[model samples]
Every structure is written in C-alpha cells, then in structure tokens.
Target: MNIAIVGLGVIGGSFAKGLQAAGYTNVYGIDVSESTLKIAVDQGMIKKGFIEANDILQDMDVIMISLYPNQIAPFVEQHKNRLKDGAVLTDVTGVKTTIIEKVSNILPSTVDFVFAHPMRGSEKQGIIGADHKRFIGANALITPIATNKEASLQLIEKLYKEIGFDQVTRVSPEKHDEQIAYVSQLMHVLSVAVVNSQQASEETLTYAGNSFQELTRIADINAELWSELFLNNRTGLLKSIEHFEIELDALKHTLEENDDERLKAIFRQATNKRREWY
Candidate 1:
C-alpha cells in the first residue's frame, strides 16, 4: 500500500522502517525539516516522498499522522478534503480522545480516519533512532470511528500484523488515554521529577546507585514535544501524578516510623503485582 506519513519523527520514522521491513513499497513522508527528510531517505525508510502536503496527496493510499497532540486537530482539518475518498487515515499520537474528537468534528464524510496508538516508544527522537524491530511484538491499539468501514479498519489491522504486531486490540479513545497516563505519561513525569530534585555535582553523580540512575533515564526528555503532550492531556496526567504522590507519601511515613512489617508488606504487594508480568 502507498503510505504517506506526516511528522517524520520517532513514531513516523519507525512506521516507515517497519513498512519497508514488512515488504511494503511506495512509502511517502512529509516533514518541515529538510535535514530529517534527508536522514529518512538516506536510511532507506522512504522510497520517494515530498515534503509538501498538497503536492503529495494524489496517490497516497493510507495516511498516518504521527504528530504531537495539538497538531492533530488543525492538521486533519486542513488535509481532510485533500485526501482521496475511501483512503484510510490513522495516527500514532500518545493521547487519543481529544484528537479523535477533533478529527470527528472536521473530517469529511468521504474520507475515513481511524485513531490508533502503538504501545512502543523510546527516549531518542528523530529519524536517526528509527527502528522497525522496536514494536515487533508490542500492543497496537485500534480505535475506529463510527463512520469507518469494517474492511478499511481490517486493512490497517492487517498492515500492523504484517509488521509483527498481531497482539492488536481495540480501545475507546477515552480509555486509551486514561490507561496510558499511568503506563507511559506518568513515567516521564516521574523521571522529570527525579532529575529536577537531584542537585549533585558531576563528580558526586558518578557514584549513583543503580535505581537512582534508572529513575532519571527519561528525565532529560525533549521538552518541546513532551510539553505539547503534557498540556494536551494535562487532566489525565495530573490525576495520575497526584495518585502516585499519595502512594509515595504513604511509603514515606512507613519509612519515617521504621515500620518493618508495613514496609515488608508493601514490598510484598509490589512484588506480587509485578510478578504477574513474569
């Protein structure tokens, strides 16, 4: 299928790489940065694609908008008419409810846009870090609007399956964001908090423990992009952070009292909860 991916950063670039790895040809891309486009072409993720949106919509089979949350609404509004009738549209944005609602408001009846979120990402940004293998077995969430055809939806599912993500499932856009708040967004927030709280000198930081080091792994995130996500889904994210803080505060009180039995019980509960993944 001929695919046109907008916002050629991590998720967009990875989609191109995965499409190629799955033996799909005629993959196209659109991004504002010339340098990133060059990196994508040089890496052979795209065969040939134009940076101009209007110039490249003629033969676009399926469109994937992997942009930051705020862009989803206006971007789709502008391009809804340009996309060919019956062409399926989808996205890889982190939060889906607002985006899906924005899409629903502006989308023409002719073109169908489905909302999907692949549960895979990395700290790195841009085409430089694009890897097809990253989401090989990861969960890919598909949430189609009421207007979308069953066959068209299946086509998107088939494409993901071909790229080795058959563990696909359905989700309502609202629930997708609520679940992701704890699983993905809150993790970034915690990492940022850890990095912000630390005031160690460079030499002093060199002796950090394993857990301390791990806590800050995602702290130095790309602020510009992450800022967009955090604000767009601010409500859900704030609730997740608040609940996490409450849990942490309870543990702090346990430690202050040297409550051995309570600490052991808390650790045991965490272990039991974590063991389910094993």
Candidate 2:
C-alpha cells in the first residue's frame, strides 16, 4: 500500500495517519509547502515526504488529491500520465462531476480514478490536524462517474471501509455535486454571510450570544480555500442560496405582517421537520 497524499493538509494528513494506525506502512506525503511536509515527517504521520508531484507518484500504489477544487484539473492533467499502471487515484475534494469528468477525459484507461468525498472536517488545518478520529464514524460518499463505476467503485468502497469510515454510499457525480451544493457548500456560504452581515466590532463580539456564536463559528474559515469552492460550485451554490433566500423572505413576511397564525404554522412546520429529520 504505497499511498501518496498531495496536500498533506487536514484531510490528507488525517487519511495518512488513519492508514498508519490501521497497520499500513509505506505512506508518502507530498505538498508544495515545505513546512507542512516537515510537520508530517516530524509527527511520523507519513513515512517520507516529497515536494514535487512527479516524485510522489513514482512508487505510489494509490494517490489521493486533497487540493482545492480549482487546482484539481491542472494537477490531474500533470499527473494523469505519470500514475503507475493499475494504480487507483481518488480525491478528497468536495465536488465530483467537474473533477471526475475532466480527469477521466484526460487520463489513460489504465489509471483508475475513484472519486470520493468524506463528509468530515474541522475548523483546523495542516498536519497538526491529522488525527483521523473525525472519520471514525463519518459517512463517506463514494461517487463514481458513469464510465468509471464498474471499473473502480467497489475498490474505493473497500478502501473507505478499511479506513474505518462508518458507511459507504455510492452516487453519480451529478447527484453528488447537487447534494453537496446544499449540505456542504451552502452551509459555508451561510456561515460567511451571517458573519459578514454582522460586521461586528470587537466590542460587539464580546457581547455576542451563544446562538450567534455557534452559528458563526465556521465563519473563521480559510478564505482562500473556501472562496475557490464557492466559485467552482457557483452554479449549484447560487441555487441553494436562492432557495434559502426565498424561505427567509417568507419568514420576514410573517413577522412584518404580524400574522400570529401564520407564524405559529411556520414554527410548527419547522419543529416537525427538525424532529423528523435524521
């Protein structure tokens, strides 16, 4: 199991450490950030480290791309041909259709790219955030493109299970991206918008309520990384935001009209939905 992780950030580091803890060896960390590589090596998260993409794939049996969405196309283009024959290359990237489609279009048939998304993360970053505890019982969605489903879906699911993921669900790229656009991408947008709308002064934060505090916690996100995701999945995210706006407007209408009956009905609906939700 010669595994190569390109980002060496939170997800990559977590997966590397998880594999190691599962008794696997020969894991390699690859990242452009020299500091990140040093941190992983010092922590023994990966057996060794490499700075270049080429160096990392030389002996890699499986490669996981943990870079941002915008970086996926170019990264795949450069490494598609270099992959060892019969090697399985998957990614921890959130969006699937865009990445899987472009990569499959460019890569050779010998290379199997099993697209997957682990719906787990923390507000932290870098190798320090490498422990795979968050993934112990998290659901991992293994998204395989139509052309690649029969080719590598089973292998990807097996790997996720071996990594201690709680459950493995499969879906097409189109469906995966559509759902993520709401659950993952939309939440980030809402968090950003909520925090920005406040534009709170230092004093205001000092007086913030628990509810306000909890809602805006994710606002302390990596702007560069999140901004890329919002833009990459702009079409889907915009649609999610639009749906949210419509609902919010309806609530505002109820409040402005002081329609007690309508408000109660709305609250009842929300309560029922929340209670019924999984």
* Per-model TM-score on C-alpha atoms: 0.93, 0.93
- Per-residue alpha-carbon lDDT of candidate 1 for residues 1-278, written as tens digits (9 for 90 to 100): 67999988888999999998889878988998888888888889888767788888757879999888788889878877688877888888788777777778888888888788888877888888888788888888887678889888888898888887858888887788888888889999888876776575667577888888888888869888788878878899999999999989989999999999998999999999999878
For model 2, the superposed segments whose C-alpha errors exceed 4 Å read: 149-151
lDDT (Cα, 0-100) at 10 in candidate 1: 82
lDDT of each: 0.84, 0.83
lDDT tens readout by residue for model 2, 1-278: 78888898888999988878877788898899899999888887889888988976867888888888878778878877688888888888788777776777787787778888898977898778777878888899987665574646777677677888989998877788788999888887787777777566777778889988888888889878887777767788888889989989989999999999998998999999999985
Candidate 2 backbone collisions, by pair: none
Candidate 1 global CA lDDT score: 0.84
Indicate the residue-level lDDT of 278 in model 2: 55
Which candidate number would show the highest lDDT if scored against the true structure? 1
In TM-score terms, candidate 1 sits at: 0.93
